[model samples]
Target: MKIYFKTFIAIIFGVSLLGCDPAEKQNKNEEFPILGRKQFVERTVNGETVVDTIDHTIPDFRLVNQDSIWVTPKSFENKVYVADFFFTSCPTICPTMKKEMLRVYNAYKNNNSVAIISHTIDPKHDTVALLKDFAQRLDVEAPKWNFVTGNKEEIYELGQKGYMVTAMEDENEEGGYIHSGAFILVDKEKHVRGVYDGTNSNDVDRLIKDIDRLLATYNEPKTKS
Candidate 1:
């Protein structure tokens, strides 16, 4: 499953440059594709056996944010959000990632339809107090940008199986851990719609534009078949 997920991610990165701007290659009315592995379930429909498709989604999670509020999937109900994994003390790419993320935070800080969540991979070192101070230094607050920490194993599981991103401790790597620099874009339904390199300005720009595109999807009027 990990191999399949990685291959899909490789494909996304491979063609990202060509399709970064949906308006350039796709109809403006077209919705962003739901990313991640999907499954085919057999079910009975009108007394006939039919196969149903179920797209991958971010599973339920419970983590405490900097403000001491219990953050859960319910916190993002009826909204689209950007999610990423990082620790406050990361020495290598985290600084750049957060710098780029600020662009995203400033873009949608006031937009209630969007939100951002950052998970700390180094939970032991990144305590709630540290995360709070970290958010203060960044000049960001919750409900707009949430810096959260929780059980180390649960966080890792969410990062890997739920968000389909890499997040784990690696002593050999700089900062004492290794995690993906990709920012995941999840829709109201919890399905991942896009992923961007959080350390790259150009990619972050694409992410900002994609957020607008994704929000527009919600405003689109429903049509009858």
Candidate 2:
């Protein structure tokens, strides 16, 4: 079985956005597909062979937030979050990404079950104080939206491997760094459910709606065997 990665999902998602009707596309009851390569493991269950599905999840990370508070998976425990990579000095898409992210922040600002985390790829320049000021300027705050910085290698690795997005330094690129402007939607279990272009307002609008859809998943009745 082949791993269905984000690139493939992105293309498919873009096509759906163009081809589908908003009113009929994503029903409130429809569950978002977990976006990532799933693994299958064979197991013996009551003397029978069974294949188990293992979802792709965000890996553990330790980074310092704007408030100088250490942030980890534990910080987002039991909550669905939106995540992206950016730096304060970025001269290109970062501004648009943040502008769109503010909408997400406001939509769920009062909803404690939701949160947002942004990683700065240029941690050397994007210090804790810088991130603090950046968030303050955006009129966002911690626990609701966290702008974080730490070891550049760890941030890049997490962005590429964990979030399945691009994050790296490139002198040839503007602002001396390059990263994906995708806002990733992670479920309560840290499973990625969707990815949208943070620079696109239409995509962000869809993301806002998807967040509600994702949250609704938790309110459903549980099934018992």
Candidate 3:
């Protein structure tokens, strides 16, 4: 009877160990979709030649930030960033999006590796001075969070072709321009790792969780020096 009981306890212990495995837990993180180009020819692996799938990345852009500084893709080099479109005068979904973005800002306020880039769809009205005032009103500091504005056509092209979001003018729309209420998650390599609805609390919660996961990918296990 003692031998049989000991074997049963041992089996239970093994099962519990398996259930608590960290690798298993980590594997449960939902993999965020990569938006943009599917693949590209990297280089010839050998004389035999090889092609590699391309991870679509946010294209290079130059726009003036709240501080009246020219912000470019290089500004976010080796950093993960959240991106969205909003104008200072927006009266509809932009307010909700900004509220949700504040949640993201609070989460990574002190983390230098994280940043947020908000572009203005109505660049004509959202000039650098106007953006600066808007950022101040929102209690956001420059460099960490940038409210950028530039050529309307360029910004629109970036919204559609670069970030895969909508940004266009419409007379019937409440805000005058129609833009997506999405908060885009970009990795250190400029790749769009995830897209969350900026107006939904639940989606923003997932965005926060996924940001941690995305950061984990960069925190590779260090080797003993």
**Candidate closest to the true structure, highest lDDT:** 1
Would you list the clashing residue pairs of candidate 2?
none
Worst 10-residue lDDT window for candidate 3 reads 42-51
Pitting candidate 1 against candidate 2, the one with the higher TM-score is: 1
lDDT of 3 at 224: 39
CA deviation > 4 Å runs, candidate 3: 1-29, 42-47, 222-225
In candidate 1, stretches whose alpha carbon ends up further than 4 angstroms from where it belongs are 1-31
As a TM-score, model 2 comes out at: 0.85
Top-scoring candidate (TM-score)? 1
> How do the residues 1-225 of candidate 2 rate in per-residue lDDT, one tens digit apiece?
145687788889998878777656566446568988899999999999999999998999999999999999999998999999999989999999999999999999899999999999988888999998988988889989999899989999999989999999999998998889999999999999999999999999999999988897799778743
Off by over 4 Å in 2: 1-31, 223-225
The lDDT of each candidate is: 0.93, 0.92, 0.89
Backbone atom clashes (below 3 Å) for every candidate = 0, 0, 2
Residue-level lDDT tens digits of model 3 in 74-155: 9998789999998888988889999999999989999998999999999888888999888899899879999999999999
lDDT, residue 73, candidate 1: 98
Superior by lDDT: candidate 1 or candidate 2 = 1
Candidate 1 C-alpha lDDT tens digits along 1-225: 999999999999978865777656566656678999999999998999999999998999999999999999999999999999999989889999999999999998789989999999999999999999999999999979999999999999999999999999989998889899999999999999999999899999999999998888788888743
Error (Å) of candidate 2 at residue 44 is 3.0
Candidate 1 collision pairs = none
